[model samples]
Target: MIWQPLLLSLKLGVIVTAVMLVITLPLAALFTRVRRRWLALVESFATLPMVLPPTVVGFYLLIAFAPTSPWGAWLERTIGLRLAFSFPGIVLASCIASLPFMLQSLKSGMQGLDSRLWEASYSLGKGRVETLLRVILPNMRPALFSGMILTFAHTLGEFGVVLMVGGSIPGQTKTISVALFERVEALDFAVAHRYALVMVVISYTAVLALNLLQRVQLERRS
Candidate 1:
């Protein structure tokens, strides 16, 4: 029983983390290279989820994902897929909600790299893509790990956006957070405790690992 939601949360985390990585890599790289007023506006929009209330974000996402909405309707009609109250819906929601954490980490990593490295790569006749894959990414292991783990951790605890979009469907969208809420609502403190404890342990471990990684990076730099 408890294992179900736990496993679901893990699945959700993995999928969302993977998807976010694919989505953010180029965006982060772009943000790292570009300097313009419009880019700041785009960055702000990307980072908005961190500041906005979860419910507020969820509410708007819900509207957008609703079948009645043009975006949702076109998706369903064209792709034969539905977003509202579905696993894919929550995945989308989680990706949007966790975008900034991964993007900022990778962007910071890119920005921190020696600009001379890029110049050297260009002098060596390497394209931007080759440089990113070979030179930039290899040097940013800490940031890569931080982005992946933080995004995974954040997805595990996601409730409002996921709940609003995916609802509490068992064996599908019913993540540990949603399970915890249900257990509490049912006056089942024991099960709720288990769920909550699992989340705390996982989230704390992720954060601790990130801190330790940063410390190690600092030590190596010093």
Candidate 2:
């Protein structure tokens, strides 16, 4: 029983993290490079989820992804997909909720590097895309690694958005966090505790490992 939820959470986190990295890559690059007036607005939008309660975002997702809204209708029409009370809904919710961590990490990583490196690369004949792929991305390994682990852990613990958008469809959308709550609600405290303990240990171990890796990488760089 716990295995189902545990595996579901791992699946969700991995898929969400992959999509987030790809989708947010260009946005993060543009964000870190641009000298635009709207940078603050975009930054604020990404950071809003971090500050707001997950329930607040979930409530809006319910509305925004519901058939009543044109945006949702258009999405459904285009992709032949429904968003409400579905696994896709949970994925969408988690993606939105976890975006800031990835974006901030990537942005900070890009910004922290010496700008002259980009300039030098560009001057030497590397195109923007090439330089980004070969240089910027390599340099951002630490942030990218940390951000991925953080997002995975956060998604594993996500509750409110999953509850709001994804009904606990036992084999489909029942992530560990949601499953744990259901167990508690049914007064199955023992099982819930076990699930919780596993999650805590996994998360702690991942962060500790990532920190040590970051330290080693930093030392090598210095």
Candidate 3:
């Protein structure tokens, strides 16, 4: 059985989760601090992906990455990197598709932080970055783990967005989900079953870990 697709999926999930954590941590913190009337609009924009169809997101990403589009053209001309139909393209698409999972989880954690803790840190002359790293992050361990796991698992199982952006380039963009679809299309049910079973196990493991983590968190709180 071909293993490249599964490996690619794992690589994509790790990269996506790492990047998402870096980007989402600051964004979630910012979201929790904003008190303006337009905060709802900003939040809705961030959470839009959770409800939007994966195909719809993929369609827009495809257009944005097309060689003729200005963004795509600039990247190609400046960096000599074309995102469309490439591994990077799949990563970008998965990032967008799985963003809300991380954002919401992190945001909820950030919001739960006591305002007095921020005040105390500031009183001690700690910078926002220092406070976030030293205090906020330690307290946010559960949420961080949840977000990372969810993003990783979600990206691993992504079908529509990855397919639309990356196509089925072997050892490049053919992730496990896309590979499974191709196998089924080629009437290779036996191989498809193997892929499906693997995915099932992955999904079950993620769910079990999340539940255990939640139980631990609840016990600590109580």
**Candidate that would win on lDDT:** 1
- For residue 177, give model 1's deviation from the true position in Å: 0.3
Residue 8 CA error for candidate 2 (Å)?
Answer: 1.0
Minimal lDDT window, size 10, model 3: 34-43
Number of clashes found in candidate 3: 0
Candidate 3 structure quality by residue, lDDT tens digits, 104-126: 99998888879788889989999
Residue 92 in candidate 2, Cα distance off native in Å: 1.2
Compared with the true structure, what per-residue lDDT tens digits does model 2 show for residues 123-212?
999999899889899988888898888888888889998888887998778989998999999999999999999898988988897889
User: Residue 58's C-alpha lDDT in candidate 3?
Assistant: 91
Candidate 3 regions off by >4 Å?
none
TM-score of each: 0.97, 0.94, 0.97
Per-residue lDDT tens digits for candidate 1, residues 1-222, read 789999999999999999998889889989988878799999999999999988889999999999999999999999978998988999999999999999999999988889899899999999998998899899989999999999999999989998999999998889999999999999999999999999999989998999999999999999
Off by over 4 Å in 2: none
| True-structure Cα RMSD, model 2 | 1.5
